[model samples]
Target: MVTLRSHTREKARRSTWAFLPPEIRRMILEEISRQRRWSCASTVCKEWHAIVATKNLNRLELNGASAEGLSKIILQRHLVRQIYLNIELPAYTCPQCRGFASSSEHGKLAKDALRKLSKALAAWEPTHHITLELNAYSPNDTDHCFKNHLYGFKHENDGDLLEKQEAWDDQRHGWVKGKQVRLPTTGAIQQLFSTVISGVQGERPQKVPAVKGVVIRRQMRRKIDRLALPKLLKQFPNLESINYEPWRVLFHQPDLLDSSCERCDQMLQDGLPKWPKHVRSVTIFEDFNEQIMEAIRSGIDPTISSTSMQIENGRRTRYGLGEAFAVKSRHLEHLSVSFMIDARDFFTSCKTLSDWPRLRSLVLTTPLMTKGPQHRMSDFLVKAGQVAQKMQRLKSLVIWHCSHDEASAVIFLKNKRSRRNVHGSATLTWRGTRDFDFSEEVVETWQQVVCTCNSHRGYVGQCDSHQLLCRIERVEGEIISHGDAIHHLRLPDGVIDPTSLRQIRQEGILQREARAVEAEPVDGSGEDP
Candidate 1:
């Protein structure tokens, strides 16, 4: 009887659900969608199914080996909007190569997969905003970063999280989590991380991502390069954008130039490739430097925000990414090719940021360095500020530090066009340029350590506490006082906040006066009169 009553209640509630206000019903549906329970929520009633029908993209699944079926959808061009590709290419291994991975089964499989996709795309137009999310890897018997993160059991009970559901599938011979596959060990699976592009000398520039239980070889990277993925990607003139996560990437400059192709050779000489004219955005970020992370964890005195972007003949050959983006296209708006170019060649390559009128957002991440800072933050900001001055339509400009756990400089540009904002006065414009945030403890530490130089020479070193300000301000150990060091970070006068400047100046004046009083020798007269 209790079960019957419960069923009766549920049936009555379903009818009453429609009686609720339209806005309330819509809000409920939106909440469900946000939680990614769309499939379950949409089936509740006819009204919901109608609302969600368009949002759901039932992507056509196709294997890379048999992508010929994709060409048949040419008549129904609208159906080409979304696609999920499953690729399983024939492995080509050469034992004589002797542990060299480019000829390994993994590299061959990745190449074959891309070749198949290229053939299929020959029939399709490049105008669509299509993105291919590649889940390319096979089951291998080893404790790798990919496997551990995918299937590791959760030990942290304090945090609220959803348990991952996985099961053993015998047919696929792997651990399956929905469509994601993780097979148990063997040499059957080839390693893509070991692969590198042509002309990329030395080790495959790769670092393990920051995750629990990640096992990376402690020894330095070995020199064995040659993966055709980079060169092949550049050949796709139809490719409008590159979407990749840097932390998980293997190479800093994966778009390596191939010497074999005559067309590529010609483009290299021409200073620009045959990139799509309609390309709007190109963003690429670099993985964190391990040294930077170690420094921060060890509480190093200096803030290692700066890095040397040293190139091994790192000169801007036609292969430099900044040169690739130096096209004179009106359709280009947002451009970001980080870690692809260093500060040395980047500015010279794209010396025409002012020319791109429609560009609204710009993000850059320079190459990583093993040595000390290449240039001061002040000089870096000066170059960035010059770029900002000419950009009329630019709204957001970001420059990431080439290190982990270090603050990056960000500038927020705001334009107020309305006269009403100023009580029917002249049109007003607002701009804000600020550096990274500092913790209260860090600020307190700096504030406590006033420069102890009597003659106004840089002498923060005399203080009992080791001040980190000089390192951050980076005025070459010549820090006169707290304010002088801070003042080194100069933005355009128009963008700098007047209140902040005044506060800093006031503090400087007070520090100088106190420092002067402390240094005065005793009169010994004992006469106040």
Candidate 2:
């Protein structure tokens, strides 16, 4: 009896251990963190809660509730390495009055919240890296009012803000006044250099540590005043990466450049031979202006040579490839241009492509369908093929919203053939859309094309297989009966021998055996043979 009792206790303990080991449990908890409903795991037990609160959590998603909950979470000062916060700015209202706050009040609330968050972040972890994404929807009256209020508040409180505002004020007065303004002189630039050097030499904590990157997106409104940028750039000396879409007005007025060019000319004549090279990457989202293009064409000082340049809204204008990129070829490593150009004009004007030996990435976004009969998409493809053949160092190329008919594909294939023979390695990604029925021949041809293209020494690969598989999978579900679906398909005889598949069959056998064992009579009756 004592032996039987000990055996029963051992069996119960072994059964309890069957669920999962500690390492397995931790992995399951970590996997749950990737999903949006991670909080559901929190309710499972204390063991789960402790696992979920670890510092190195890879995926952090903040929904509406979590945005408000962040204040509490930050207080713990947990080692949160990465955080992604998605906040939907609620309709602003005063908590005290419980009434809809004025637009100004709403703006004040936003600014105060950001300032408080910044302070908390600074205190919690000075070295903590963060990527803040502010996703605001289409602006309404409230948004406009809020922005105005924020502007007013910054103008009043922040002295640094006043500098940019003063620059704008100077631009408004045409830069001619008894204003006694303090412009960014040579002495100030020298002082900035000294400050950076001192910080480096002393090995002291930097006042404003350099950010990894910053992205600012705003809807189209007024034109961005070019006069305002120099001062803003000066403030963030440690800035390495910046992406911004300033308002459109900056592009509409050509006169802004006329004045700027005159100013630069005067400065150059006075022996001020160099421009500041603070920014390494730049993206300008506006129509190309001829005057500004002329300034760049005159020759960019080697000191300020930019590595990346992305120009959008390059529509029908005199500022084509010849006028825009011909001169700055040596400096640009990545270039993206969107516009319509005649095939002949593009080939002839963009002949200096050899200068950009370091260029590795190129993107050309052009119209797919031609409205008039004069210009055809085929002609565009031929020209694009010629350009690709010339760019020997090109690794990644994207042609957005463009048709890739047989002729276009042939042109690309020709480039691929040449690249294989010469460079021994080159990869290109082609994306397109077409309306065609799915057939065995089509599938075979696509597979052949993919295999042949990828067999080359430098052929990285293509995405046709994965895309076609997805389409076929979708169609399979639509055509097949529920019972005959691919998920329920039995393996072929040769694919897996019955003997190997038989192991899982034992589970059914055991279940039947259990039923038979349970059904045995109380008198211990023998099985009915």
Candidate 3:
């Protein structure tokens, strides 16, 4: 009983309360949470260990030394909640710091250990949310200098061991091939080669539990192979979004499907599967091949033809959409497309806006210059005016990264023409550099036209009765400029217009007052601006 009491006293001493107040302790814990490294907190005293474990702070990056360490943390439910596993391959470290050289036994052991860690994480559950970043290059393989050092044991017919070693070197062309000749048929070299080939082929579907999304950086070279893409897609049934780099879609001339439309039709029928109807959204970077394009064009459903399409600098082909391509998607609420398309082609593609009855918003981000100057500002404006007349349900129009001054001019002209018609009123939002201030010039020109029309004997602001025609507002950041005369404009209700002159003098007065107040130096300071 006395001995038990003594042991209990020692335990109590070890569990003594931390010195800092509760508030200070909380502040420290929060600070620790913000740190990138969790090992520092883990190394602290027993109380700190408990606190860190309880707080569950730190995004667990399972790579290098920490890969094996993850097994322990994952078992602790509280710690697992704090961690977001980032599974990356091991980096190659030199023998000096890594305490393992390629030639040494310890080096081999370390490599095996890291490989085991990778295998373990690959088998972990709830894999979907884990950010599995597969890098093509390992960190330690930095300069390609280490390739010279890897060695493999060899055998020779020569009686001398040194002679055998020399023979092996000659066969390998200097650097050792890390394989043992005496090993059984199913040796490490065969296994390694097979593993590498399988990895490249992506034949092994990584069991990612509950994966909501996946990002593949490298182009799946074998995607066209048997059951690759279909199998991969099956893994992510609940995938909401997939963001791929532009290079994934390789644009190759459709050699198999000649230039003939019938040939294109046959190839698509023979090669590609029907579209996955469940996939609501798909973003492709490369210009679609003729076969794919034909499949899209000739698809049975009108809705499929009307589905929102985005292209980048693709050559003009008679996509079977005919008039349907020009029609807005009744189902497609958002659409973004960019490329060098002819004005006539654009209008031809999307001529009937009435078909897209539910098309509420549209985004057109195309390069400004396309071919010659014949299809200039005036031509585009005339065509846009015709199209805008049909968008009866459009509520917002956003144009981003435009190249030519003509595009904005066309939009303004279209808006002006539409406003004159019975059904043309929508908020136009333009985001681009003010390289061409044609909107201001257009507004001024329109104002002059309105002024001249109203100047006639009986007309009293009758011709300038429209709200959009009367107000021309240009907003850049916080500052807004209207017609050439008004440097700034302020609205009475704090809502400025993009197309009229409304109380311009009040904006001037506000600016002048602000400048005057700013000019008066504060206290003993020098003159202010």
Judging by TM-score against the true structure, name the best candidate. Answer: 1
State each model's CA lDDT, in order: 0.36, 0.32, 0.33
- After best superposition, candidate 2 residue 95: deviation in angstroms? 23
Show model 1 residue runs off by greater than 4 Å.
1-55, 58-104, 111-128, 145-190, 194-239, 244-272, 288-331, 349-354, 366-375, 410-412, 416-529
lDDT for model 3, please. Answer: 0.33
The weakest ten consecutive residues by lDDT in model 2 span 191-200
Residue by residue across 1-529, what tens digits does model 1's lDDT show?
9999999988898789777889998887766655544756567677876555334433444565665665565544443345545444233333311122443454455445545655665656645434553434333321221222221122322232223222222224333432223222212222323432233223332211110011111111111122333443444544555443222111222233221222332343343344334446554432222211221223322444432211121212233444555453234566654444444345555565446677766655433221223344434444544545455566555444222112223333333345444222111111112232333433332222222232145332333232223212222322222223224433223221243334334433432332212332211011111
Q: Pick the candidate with the highest lDDT.
A: 1
Badly placed stretches (over 4 Å) of model 2 are: 1-23, 34-51, 54-129, 137-210, 215-359, 368-393, 402-529
Shift in Å, residue 308, candidate 2: 34
lDDT of 2: 0.32
Per-candidate total of colliding backbone pairs: 3, 3, 13
lDDT of 2 by residue, 340-456 (tens): 222334445666565446555543333342121213444544455455545555444444322111101111121344323542222222222232223443333333332444544
Q: After superposition, how far is residue 200 of candidate 2 from its true place, in Å?
A: 32
Question: Candidates ranked by TM-score, best first?
Answer: 1, 2, 3
Tell me the tens digit of each residue's lDDT in model 3 across 216-256. Answer: 33221111221233444444444433322111121222231
